[model samples]
Target: MFRFDWKMTLFVLLLLPVLIRLGYWQLEREAEKRDLQQLYEERQSSAPLPISGVDWSDKDIGWSRIQAEGYYETEYNFLLDNRIQSGQVGYEVLTPFRTDYGVLLINRGWIAAGPRREILPSIETPEDKAVIEATIYIPDGELMMFGEETLSGEQWPKRIQQVHLARMSEALGEKLIPARLRLSAGSAGELSIDWQTVNMQPEVHRGYAIQWFLMAAALVVLFVFFSFRRKEKPNE
Candidate 1:
């Protein structure tokens, strides 16, 4: 015998769509992650290309290995906060490089945070022009902004929460390149550079998708079991 519960049915209907949508969204994300991984692998295997005359609008430029000759703009530097390395909290140093092509931001590397928040670690910048090899890194999306604190002051060695290329370019009065150069291994830089190829592996997204679908399936089974089970008759 079937007993229909309107409220329960309505709840199930509402939740089912949401669960299905989430699973599908995860699948879409998995596909995107796979495509990104493939592109990254292809770029990594290719030879290092010169930065000069490269089309900035090209979508694939983000992962490309590049070489450039430029002088560091030591005075105006940026400290990207909340970077972790070797189980220690620190900041990633970013300094501008004035190259013949254009101004490019170079992520020098990570430095440990000071003992107190008021104090900052010392960063040395090379003044001379030199050949630099690095990987192009374009930020995936907009970063969460803490507040105006990161944007305050016109001081050298400015500490920022995230790298806002447009804002920084305007502040510096120069059209900086769209992407940042992650200092390649064995490059001449003060700090350490440890970059990951991808932020999240596709397998993780696929796992999440499976979990969501399983949850949806379980919900349907539970709903059916609860609706069909007959209540025990009370003994007179």
Candidate 2:
């Protein structure tokens, strides 16, 4: 059912460098994220709280202070250029909600395209108070032409699929939530939640790491097979 040939080998070798480069990038990105997560966890442990375990005054809640810190944000073209699945586009829309314990950052949903140059997307924030939970992330800031910040009172129901938490915080104007929450869509209008942060999962990153390595391996095997092929003797 499967066939292997020298042409395949040559092709693989030719592509090996590209595959390796991509794998390296993924590894690097994942490593950077790991470091950030570790640092966040550490800060959470040593950081002082405001007498009470949680600070409800801020619009959002964060383990540490709700200050600007760097994180990863995916580029728009990177998503399309890579031919990612449909529905993956501009920004990962995040909203905040109050809770008994504290605030949580809920990833309300994804916007398909960039928000209009002069407009902001209509995000139905949860009016009912509840604590929000989410990890702080920074955007990659690639392939984007960020426009001047949009002022409040300009309500446009367009989709703004871009993330710039710092800028967003300004737009929001309330104390601004510290962390983010990834919401689950279900039967009712309830904000779905996962107590554990998604980035904490080793399996997801490991699986991706394995994929990049496998592609590199495949290329090498192909190159070797083609290199060893023997030529036929000339006919007398």
Candidate 3:
């Protein structure tokens, strides 16, 4: 009678979770690719809606935690550090725009940090404030941290870069719209767009998922190959 090794069985069993997780991830990624393809097709094939909501809304939505970064701390991080762009600290200057149908939030842009905490910058705020064609997005507020330096819902003197979306919402005292708009370039006070800050493509994740799955597959194959080779060899 042959004796079975529990260690080999345990090793194979441990691979289950990795297999399940990566298998699910691969499936989810395929679904996303299909969904995006369908969305693009609808946009192309269907008659355009006379009144369209911000197209760039979710495209720019990112994980937020308000931690300042950059040489001058002159950038805002979006979507879990997905994208960053040069903008200063101040009120996150928001403006309402009346579209053909209703109103929507427009993140006109960020203001440069004031000379000191309370000293407002001399930059001009848009006076005409109507619906200028804008790019849509969502702004993440500050993230809460467990430390002495962590302060929630309080204004600070120096530049306060952070990721706390909830804190930002509390400070603003408004249920922020799900999305914001970036005023088009050449629009009043048009700020530069930092392309480097865009979130990584979902495809990158799919590729990673594939690599993990392949590694798991290789392990299983090696296990089987060794087991069969041992059975075929003559006993010493």
Candidate 4:
């Protein structure tokens, strides 16, 4: 018969559930990542469509190739801070492009920050009209303070930590299209293009899940080996 040490059993009981739970959690994450990659792949394979042709009701329009013709609001620009590219700290230049349909925030590209925090880089935006080919990125709704903004106060090429649609709208004195367009290569005003669609692959999550499950299995094996006892012969 097998005998279990109370303390060891209790330890296994406590730690096993945590290990199993972590494995399941990683599996769930893997599933979610797979779904996102599938969606991204489906959208990327299609042809570019006019920005105005898309239906607003479709919420999963990310990576949707799009084209738009408009003049950039060169006077007002935004610098998205803490954007890193090629292991160098920089900012993503977000310029307002006024289209006939609506005003859209165009992610031009990454620009290196200067030696000092206060000294901002100079971005020369052509005042002339431009037709840009880009991808539409509809970000998820964020929980924000009722009236708070992430902008760097009243300043040209304002630095922002986050993309708050309502805050940007308030700053621009008008409502924006709620979507940030990433300019394609060779397009007007486009700079360094280093976009990472999926930061972590599903395989990574799957590997983590396997590790957690293996830990749980090892714990079970050790518990079983320690708790087992050989039958003893009867004594006279």
* Alpha-carbon lDDT, every model: 0.84, 0.45, 0.45, 0.84
Tens-place lDDT per residue, model 4, 64-153, is 888889999988988888888989998999988998998988999999999999999999787888888888865433335366555646
Residues 94-157, model 3: lDDT tens digits = 4434444444444445555456755644434444433244443333224564653333434432
Error of 3 at 94 (Å): 5.9
lDDT of 3 at 70: 12
lDDT for model 1 = 0.84
User: Which numbered prediction scores highest in TM-score against the true structure?
Assistant: 1
Candidate 4 ranges with C-alpha deviation above 4 Å: 5-8, 138-152, 229-236
Number of backbone clashes in candidate 1: 0
TM, every model: 0.91, 0.42, 0.51, 0.83
Stronger candidate by TM-score (2 vs 3): 3
Ranking by TM-score: 1, 4, 3, 2
What digit string (tens of lDDT, one per residue) describes model 2 on residues 1-236?
23457677566767877877777776776776676567657755653443235544554343343221122121111111111225343444454343433333445444444345443333344343332223333333345656754434533231333544465555444344555434333411232223343233544566677798898887677566656656556982
Residue-pair clashes per prediction, in order, are 0, 27, 25, 0
RMSD of each: 2.0, 10.7, 9.3, 4.3
Model 3 spans with C-alpha error above 4 angstroms: 1-3, 37-105, 108-124, 135-170, 173-178, 184-186, 194-198, 229-236
User: In terms of lDDT, which candidate is stronger, 2 or 4?
Assistant: 4
